[model samples]
Target: MSTIAKEIESTMELNPGIPIKVLQDLIQKKYQVHISLKKIFRAKVLATKKVQSDFTTQYLLLRDYCAELLRSNRDTTVTIEVEREFNPTTESRQFKRIYICYGCLKVGFKQRGGEVLGLDGCFMKGPFPRQILTAVGVYGNNGIYPVAFAIVEAESSSSWTWFLQCLGNDLDLNIRSNFTFLSDRKKGIIPAIKKVYPSIEHRYCPRHIHENMKIKWRSNMFKNMLWKAGGQSVMDYSTMYDMAANGIEGGIPESWVDEVYWLSTWKKVNENTIDPINGKEMWTPSACPTSLLPPEHHTQIGRPKKARKKSVEELSQKINTGGKMTRKGKAVTCQVCKQKGHNKRGCKERGPSTSTQPTSQQQ
Candidate 1:
């Protein structure tokens, strides 16, 4: 095989979903050899076959993976669920879902982190299509601590409920109102949280709610009023609401204003607590007047915005190079649903399926 072909194969194996153009650019930059898109596409096809084959094997080996995890980590928890349908032609059970929570991570979270939890779902852009549902906690040191994670077929009520249930069991939660959860108000999340943590506080990210409102009320005045409502105390929130409801040319919707009030109420309950991670006083829901909240609403309509900054590898490569890196246009085809103008992470195709079965748990 040619040197460029070898590099392409290696890169594809390392990052299965890398774009053809990205591969072409890297080869030309590193080896100073300009390869045609046709050749790159052919290499990608070969890489895709390898990726799919590996995923098939991975599904079959999931049982072993769970066993190995349990063996390596005492008191670790793991669960795997398979599709119910009988694939008579393949004569194999299809992969459905899996959850993992190491004992050390669970213990560290309980000891060092605050009661608040942040939950979100990310799309996995690999040979095996799935969503990784993650539960993270905030430490007193203002660090994000991983609590648990689940790989599910999609981010639906059933999947979220199962993940939370597993997390609750692993953490030995008391099923009380002490625990607070912050998340974007995704479709299945509210119902799922109610089911698993009915009494616990579930807070929506304010930024998300604003995006939904901006579509209808794009005025700068409306935007300022909405932000004021979020940052204010209960009394101030009501005053801001009145300004938006009555002051704006086209009054803010009663429904949207009401929801913001509800979110502020969620913040009012947080209390000040000692930061176990830092050994200093840290803002809990009660004491911290200004806690960072998640966004208000997630439309889940288009390519999801990147929540993180560039990595060290990316920054290092661009440091001395005089050439500038151009970002791709916002418009692109989604790899997940094969739709235009959206990326894989924001694909709207995977709605909550009615066929999702009950969640399974193992310790």
Candidate 2:
């Protein structure tokens, strides 16, 4: 019994679990013991179930060691395989198909007519450290559809280029005509895309440009002005440009103007315009206000008014009467809704109550 416990502990140290059937099989094979497999399996199951109550201390130490090793070797891959003594064929088949489906779903495939590709990377957690996940999408019918993704490291220009090149090789995007590439203003993305597909129209997302604008201009007025400028049509560029330029003249910072100009120019180049500032000939909605795009895409053209507190008298009246004053200075109750002048709880439409008490004890 002590030998079996020691063996079980050693096996668990390596693999965490040994099914009762597996322990019984090992005992029979190695010791040539004559014991009913069913009885042995039941006894082992009961014993191990008991041990689980105290397994936390051992498991936590093992988990901590595994975590430390993972941190030390951030670039390593580990694969694990388990051999079960008793296999359930149906469950195994189901799990196999589920795994295959997971892979297929991760690598999305669809019928996108033309292959104008865009790529971006995000971080994820796994056995590997700093897993940079790359997403592949196509621009068609004026929309983007993500098709494939991969986990990678570092979002350097070289890393980005390699990822795209590998994708192109696998997907055969060379034949697509005038593929337009769009991404954030990452230093490497533009150069990488230019090198790989020179003919590809490279455009920086206006949303990213808008974010840069916010960083450049802390003032809400200037930020709003920039947004309006980015959304204006090409024909309206002069108007939008002058509006932005005038805004700078009217206390909008010069740095903000320069940032807007840079974004406008980038948008122009991406849209294949000869001159972005010419305003009259090349104006489009895409050329207008830069702030119209982004993390906050709403158009905020006017200055933000400071929120003022209600007058003391007004607040006092509100609390005392549950009434509000309209623009015309008329006080009204929301009492039916507890609004001014009416109480909803005492509305007359609910029928009169019935009397159940005797009338003054029949006096």
Candidate 3:
């Protein structure tokens, strides 16, 4: 192990994910002797610890790190909530959730931002697998402006509720905020938003809705219907009703609309309007608490995914990197049903008999 560690000690920092098989080959070339794949794996683990240290030690530093944010940036929020269980053997707490909203982001939102806020959560892949919930506002420049984010145990209703509540408290959410949420309609997020901001308008992402539609309907007509709601507004609806309902500022004189939609409004560009908070800060706790145990990740069957599963629409989109073309909106066709976007078990049209037909052997 020591010999193997010395061989790839430098490689760990440069590329931690370098495969064990690669390391085994490298060691063989360097030392002119063959090493087992299992020993190479053990050496890689040791080198990882030497480089990054134990993850549990990192969790211990979060309290002081959070304190630094509060000190350097006024009106910043850093909440750390732990689970109820305490191991007497280790004197450690189970980390439940932590929400962070830097003051700079809040200032940006307050000074100039659109009414629309996008919320989403995804799995945080690591030893301690959790969920990261994020809320970003539509910037004056139409860019994604980060507002707040939280790391929680799971992306469930309770966790979402907690994250939203923390966000609401920081943003001081109310009727005046007039914030419209746009989400992909994840299972728990809808209920959580409704609970936190009951009066606020919730909108769905057309792309995500279309992805769901692809599972059931695969025709070209089905795809076009997804985009029917959008486009130039026609003169069909009562002008008064259109003004009051569909648009934020319907058929307005260009000058009457808020400068948020205007690109030429540059008067405030020179000014330090909201005095955005400093993100770089350091704090050293004189006496820090006991380090929390590294959340044990039980080995699960099957290979773990590094990249997120993309929808057919996302996958079908042409890559601009090298100008590669793709067959747009195509998905996996179920062998049983001959439908796109699903496998045999997931095929709604395929019954048990029909599903088994593919695997049946001729007598």
Candidate 4:
């Protein structure tokens, strides 16, 4: 194992998703030694552990992070809830949900106010995938200004209720607040909104309307026309009242990952003890009441999917490249010629023919 330690390390860095069987074969060919698959697997596990914090550590750190958020930024609301289980003095409680509304963003949203608030949630990808709900406000200049966000077990009515409750408390939103909420027809959101702010106006997003239409009528020309006909701009959530009704198991992700979702990563509490607002070291007391155990790992059935499902138009525009996920509705470009409509294999150059002048010789 020591002889090929560097080999495995480099390979893992280059392509972490390389199959274990393939790695085993490569080792045999290169090092001329046979190592058990179990041993190889163990090495890979140790390497991953070294790179990323496990679920337990991140969960433990979440408590301290909340403390720092409050300390550095005054009036910023950060709430965390965990399940109360029957355990000894040793075990940590399982995480239920967390809501964060930065003081700067909250104030900014209020000052540069708009009546409309956009709410949406997307799936967080990884070993212990969960839903992340967000409430985004529009800037006076018509840009997206995020007001608050929350990470919850699922995108359900109960979760939405809890999240909205927290948000209402911070923003002073009530039954008479009269703010317009723009959102999609998620299963739980309507009831949740009605329960929290019954009198407020609820609006449906045009993009979401188009998406719903796509499910029934799959047409590219229709998609283009819909966008051109109804050009629109974006999307809005809450925290805790109860957990008795929902029976979700608790713990969190087994590994650290990703760079694509910069906002997601930033919100995930990037390796930081420093507070972003005040630029101070965010610290927690030596001892505390809340001990959050990571959400429980739920092994999903079937192959895990990282990419989001594409609409019919997106699938139609893209040609299948053996086992590779295609970008949504993006034209394929050739690597060799950097031209659209063809891939590297079929790339070619075409230019206008030059005219031959035989006038001098003929004359």
Candidate 5:
């Protein structure tokens, strides 16, 4: 009975909206034991209490968690801002906004990540709701490299400014001339970015711009013009942008023609035979390796190091030659419906409809 109760509780914890009757039916089918609706309801209540208690425990331990992060990772920067109201009866501080960025990420970003950064915020879901803001960049492999994250009580100008300020300090944004930012124009992000990164190139995401455009003008030609303008250099962007801005039946806003969204602005910086990692111009032709074995494993007695390390792009090209066999399987097609996924045994289509004429007995 206790084991049965535990199963119901676990299910309810995963899906709080599960119906009590469904739990009753599931228990009967799976365990061959009938469970009353009252028992299922009681189990759900216990699970809810357990989940809430867990959240409370973690909330109380947040300070210790922040301390552990700094202690384990040296040079890590963490800032916690709290709203406090003094009460005569109870004298203690209440925690509020929390922001954390580990040191390893800062060091890694400086070493290997791209200069462009994307900023966005998402509303966190739970009993205690708040907004989570993130700063992300691309690495050599085109993967997202997270720089920092912050949890704020709301998404206002003050919150955004504070988040950006912390991020800028960690990333050393003062001297980042080549850096560019891409983001959807959230309520306060524009002002915050301008204040924090005065000279940095800030571009609105083209997807968001298109979405807003569709709300007013539903012209396919206008959208094509926007895409074409986004792909041109700064010089051509002006001509294409002006044509789209004026040529559209309902004119696009002048602010949308800003050069920040032009293809040249967001284009990836080319190394151009100069190794970005080592800051050296690479003019020499790459020598093909004579042996597959490492130098240390070679029987030769000369110096072990002769060739320069291969770039990630060079390694990826060599790796692509090694191929894997595709899975061997027979094709499946439903005889009844001629579909690929399912067989005729489980096809959902109803059989041919019965004749609409009444039987002779009725006549």
Candidate 6:
């Protein structure tokens, strides 16, 4: 036998449970051959199991060898696979029942003071550019968290209702009682919210209200009024009605009556107030009053209009084209006269007719 094998045999005989490390040292010393402790242990365990037919003794010996090997080679890796058997009928029923209960619980939770705010706008290109809807919430704690979302075409009242109803269904929200929604004063949003939660407190944001204000009153006076009204202590419907009738500073412009009408009727009840939990005041105009209704009572109006369109055509007309009407080409014909020979003003045909009927005396 090779010197290494003889050394291993002698080491095993001397100490039946010799640690793998000591066995390795003995083999190296006796045979001048180096071998890892892991190989030695594996070989010994396999040999013992084959020779020893007693199941209990073999199991105990293997367990002890494995424990010693693990201690000596702490960094060694081992892989294990697990298998389980289940009854198909029993598992299917349990899973389905759990899902149904979860859905019901979700609806109940949302119904109990979970307010949802939804907003959306169109994109530049898509099969249905107007179909996107994003939903968020103003939690009781006054923090915003996105809850549900969707995309769809058409922003009609019916379409909005369908979207909200579907969202409630998907989220398992208590669609009838749990939702209070705020959205732009688009024709569809109010009716949709009312249909779902008639008694739920739905208020608009003040930022949107000021935007509508700017559109109605281009003057600084209305801007100032918006600031003051926002700060008022009591923003009851009557107070808003009076403010709208008299204008922000009591100088109502004829052009802004319709805007004022909406403000009085549809503006959110709350304008500006500090959040009770966060202690952060809501957004308000610069001229908002110091003592006013609480933040929770205020609401906003329609979303602010987009910035006014700049007139590029008018701007081009005012620009100087470097005194060149046509670069490297014949002079252009006049569009009005459709003549190529001369410019419109310089055309002979365009001038007053030179021939005149003779007066009787001249004849």
Query: Clashes in each model (backbone N, CA, C under 3 Å)?
Result: 14, 34, 0, 17, 0, 19
Candidate 3: C-alpha RMSD to true structure equals 10.9
Consecutive 10-residue window with the lowest summed lDDT within model 3: 265-274
lDDT string for model 5 (179-218, tens) is: 7989998878998878877788999877678878866766
The predicted structure with the larger TM-score, 5 or 6, is 5
lDDT tens digits by residue: candidate 4, 69-92: 777877789888776677667556
TM-score of each: 0.56, 0.33, 0.67, 0.63, 0.56, 0.31
Q: What is the lDDT of residue 26 in candidate 1?
A: 89
Expressed as tens digits, the lDDT of each residue in 170-211 for candidate 6 is 564564565556666777777887786576667675556656
lDDT (C-alpha) at residue 153 in model 6: 39
Candidates 4 and 5: which is better by lDDT?
A: 4
TM-score of model 6 vs. true structure: 0.31
Candidate 1 stretches greater than 4 Å from native: 1-4, 10-41, 85-91, 174-178, 213-363
Better of 1 and 2 by TM-score: 1
Ten-residue region with minimum lDDT total, candidate 2: 93-102
Candidate 3 has an lDDT of: 0.72
Model 2 vs. true fold: TM? 0.33
Model 4 lDDT on a 0 to 1 scale: 0.71
Name the better of 1 and 4 by TM-score: 4
The alpha-carbon deviation from the true structure for residue 124 of candidate 4, after best TM-score superposition, in angstroms, is 2.1
